[model samples]
Target: MTDRIEKIVRDRVGEEPVCLFAYDLDRLAEHVRAVVDSLPARCRMFYAMKANSADPLLRALAPLVAGFEVASGGELDKARAVDAEAPVIFGGPAKTLAEIERALRRDVTRLHAESALELHRISEAATRLGRTVEVLLRVNLAGPFPSATLAMAGRPTQFGISEQDLPAAVAAARSLPGLRLTGFHLHSLSNNLSAEAHLELLAHYGRTVAGWEREFGLRCEVVNVGGGIGVNYADLDAQFDWASFSRGLPAVLDEFPAGVREVDFECGRYLVAACGVYAAEVLDVKRNHGVDYALVRGGTHQFRLPSSWQHSHPFTVLEVDEWTAPVPRPELREASVTVVGELCTPKDVLAREVPVERLRVGDVLVFHHAGAYGWEISHHDFLSHPHPEHVFHADAS
Candidate 1:
């Protein structure tokens, strides 16, 4: 893992617990190309810009993806600034009129209405702007599937319109002036591990949309499956099966009724997660009661993915044996350690009970699968800790 990211961190940053993120642009491009080339031409790929709106990252992905899926005005601006021509889709549960107006004025390609009222707001915004706007109804499925780590479907969530309210919402959207229901947004999974489950979810979406078309005589162009593609931080071996998924889409599309020309996968984590790694300097190593703990200079304030997801994040110890300290620090040969941050609470744990060959004070730990939610979603202002440094690496190719 360090082979791909270590030198960039070590050379650019020294001992300060710099929450560094390094991207292999070439690998990222290759992965995006593979996903794009493998999938059917009818399927459109959009990067969920919320994952990591880093300018360089956005610029790199713009050429590869069909568009950018943005939830807020800032994301919309970032997406447009990086690549002015790339289509952007604006959607969220609660969108202020200002946001709606901005999206309309900026000429966003689509607006995904999460609630009935939002449709009216979009209509009003578009009407006031005197422009036609396309919209997709974000549907929250009302049942269960192979379980996900975090669920956005099969329950009462603030994400989308429940199936029961779909008819009224559809009527409302259709009746609203300046609005066109061109598609449906069925995004439920949050960091899903199973490709089978993801495909199953997609199949369910296709079938449900087909049923909608049959029952309500609705015609749509795209089904935006908002990004929740999981990154396996616990075990590197286990990953979302992109190959099988790309292979299975044709059959899945067969389930949908005719007229749906485009299927958009707003993938954020799957595309960018592997490209980043977060490193922090170890300040102390000791035993807390019966548990071994390695305290770092930074805590969840820098990288909150582990705590937010309630999973033991995976990491590697980059032995920074160049200890210039006058006092001798305790060093371990081969032992299990729970790496904690410098936070006041115990909840700052990053990786719990992980096996490491050597860990000592001054050594740095590099957390993998951190590209998605590391800096963007973390509570960096918790203790006024310095924010992580951003580094974009070009492929040697």
Candidate 2:
């Protein structure tokens, strides 16, 4: 930990209790640049704004990233507000015609058409606007991706058009005067930390793109291997093999007739996860049924991962007392306890069976690796507890 963090923790421990989410934009921008730089020459990187739509973070990443992938009009507004010149790719399972019109008016780089109905709608909208719309047909590749196992695998997922419909869809797109089918989009299951799985997905999509190019006599300009790069929440020092991911792209590109137009990667979690920390102060500590539990003011209402995904965040207790030397306090003791939040439900757990250095009431606890999906994905106005305050570190220099 640095002196800045130590001072922030100490100050929070001394002041009135509140949860503060610290964001390190500089470190996050570096990560984004590294991934984009390592890709092939024609590759374009887009930041998935759904991960963390904080204006400050977006402003920091706007200059570093190539484009923004937006799922809704609200996200589009956010991207435009920060990086108006950055290219935008509009994608989602179900989009209103109004939203499609908004995207068309904004001249998004590409609209990922999810279904036949969406294609028709987009074509009509473009025709009304008297302009051609570039689109990527989102294909549902039948494969075993981790996202499939958790949310999309066995369930009826409404993410992309089926593989079986590709032929007809392409033919239909060709007939639509205002719509041009530029490429194919496939977003498989993500949040699984398996590089092999991503490689397999890339290979499958690559072959599919190759086949489409040959059959349609049209070069696939954009091959979007959708985002799902996992973050190192458990161990920040653990290495993520970007080399393995880069190695697989060349073969996928080789199949493109136009010699692989552009590879677009929509990344979210991998870029922002490590740069966020959620700081909360302990409110109460109790022993129940021979197990110790520390209840904090913030709960699932604030951070929903622990209860929803059974995920555990790395936590460190910060003691406010002054010390003459930089040494561990001998008076402090270690204890195994469950860190929970003040929620009405029994499932309001932040960290389960966690070991901390003798937590006490009013002591501040910092949860690490909370940059992505922490506050963006799930937030219920349930308990009326105010949302977590967001703080940005402007100088990660």
**lDDT leader:** 1
Superposition TM-score, candidate 2 onto the true structure: 0.91
> lDDT of each prediction vs. the true structure?
0.84, 0.77
Off by over 4 Å in 1: 2-4, 12-19
Clashing residue pairs in candidate 1 are none
How well is each residue in 192-265 modelled by candidate 1, as lDDT tens digits?
Answer: 88887878888888888988987787787888877777888878888989899888888988877678888888
Error of 1 at 342 (Å): 1.4
Report the C-alpha lDDT of model 2 over 247-355, residue by residue, as the tens digit.
7767656655566678788988778877788888777788889778888878878777666677677788876454344444333247788888878888888887787
Q: Pick the candidate with the highest TM-score.
A: 1
